[model samples]
Target: MRLAPVRDDVAGFDAGEAAAFDPQPVRDAGGSGERITSLTSWWHTRWCQVCGHTFRRGDRVLVADSRVRHLDPTLDCAESGGGRADEAEVVRFTEGLLATWPVVGDVPLTRTDDVPGLLAPPLGGLRRAACLFCAHTFRPGEFVVMCPCTPAARVCARAVHRDPARGLPCWESWRPGSTLKVCPVTLTRLAT
Candidate 1:
């Protein structure tokens, strides 16, 4: 049985190890005091599945899972040596972790003013999110990034660059952020 890891990260983790700084989200007054934006950042180490290399920052590497699995069907993902996984499964795993991982950040103040309601969710105004790299849809488990650039922009670090001419669809790039960074695969698809 492929067990999904039990997790406490979706709610956000403490930036510091001290119990004093653990994320104890208080709901906003204007918005439901249920969800507050996380001030923490997200990141993952770059590793080569074939070579076992832990890449340093700014190293040219596969930054998205989509690109990784697609790039070489024979390559076992750096962490998946015990089993074989298909492209869909790999992408799904990446997507799930990105969505559920509790961020390490500060609790945002609840808005007492008119906070914009998300137009798409069945929950009336709950934050809606998508992968920054692939634009895959997800309902945010963490408070979605509501930057002035896009009030409802949900993001992930799974980015890729496309190479349509060479038939290399996309490759992972780097860390994710609150703002969307549409994958080249999607961009190429949209351009057509």
Candidate 2:
């Protein structure tokens, strides 16, 4: 019979450290507040499984969990004053990110009316923008860029250009204030 690892009051030996001691795979949430179903040494590194983008330990990376509300479509385009061409340019910028990142899990290439309701408000808006290429989503006030080549235009700009090996895709920009949230992979912008 195996005994569980005893948890102590040590600083680094918090819940996360204790969970790692268990021989059986532990299901828990990460420090970033993301729900982690399993432990992976891969996460120990700054590399993002969803997009294969690397980061330093303290660097802030966006985690898109569709378990929350889907992004609003009304906010997809530029904020009225911004011209259509300007919106198009933003979209182009997002496409570049998708081309570069690894995109961890299966993402919908197109937008669907079947989008689920808000499990909870994302970091920025009434709903979070789901990634067109992977499981990632933007929190409220969180910004991302996507590629036009993707089925929709919901990619994030910040992480998109970080990795050069992935290269740039024809993309567009999606800001948090828009009424519609466009899917970078499918280019489908859904209304809130």
Candidate 3:
């Protein structure tokens, strides 16, 4: 990946910024004295800090994010017609996704509160979830991950009745006043 030049204003004068601003210099792992080629390739070959899994390039992967937790690195799925993913791979994949995406279980806030905290301006991307039971897909517009109910109560409800095959209530089923949860297109549970 191409890295942009670090702007003076963006770098700031903070001590913390100085320590972690640049990517660590990668040594020749095999002692051949050649510089590493790519971030994705280097990450796969080197020891991953987030998850302990070591990997190589050309591995098929999946990404997941839980906003409450750190993002995972790219994962090497065991079923991806490749070898089983190591523990480090799994952890890194989780952390990377969380860091990159507008994840579910993320803390909700008003624009005034959240905007300043963001690293960049709001991004438009699809956020998806799969039903554990029937494998049906749900996107952000179709469902609200951060429910208004208590966390414990909401977790239980989500676990017990989130199967699309079971025909659980739509977003409107619970909150009639919510304009945010409906499908942006058909205003139904499954927005085409």
Model 1, residue 92: C-alpha shift (Å): 24
RMSD of 2: 17.0
Per-residue lDDT of candidate 2, residues 134-170 (tens digit): 3343222223233423325434321221122222121
lDDT of each: 0.29, 0.33, 0.32
Write down the TM-score for model 1.
0.17
Residue 104 local lDDT, model 3: 38
Error of 1 at 141 (Å): 3.0
112, model 3: CA deviation in Å? Answer: 32
| Candidate 2 residue spans exceeding 4 A from truth | 1-24, 27-126, 140-143, 150-192
Hey, what RMSD does candidate 1 come out at?
A: 21.5
Q: Is candidate 2 or candidate 3 better by TM-score?
A: 3
Error in Å for residue 163 of model 1: 29
Give the candidate number with the greatest TM-score.
3
Off by over 4 Å in 1: 1-119, 122-129, 148-192
Q: Which one wins by lDDT: 1 or 3?
A: 3
Q: Give the TM-score of candidate 2.
A: 0.20
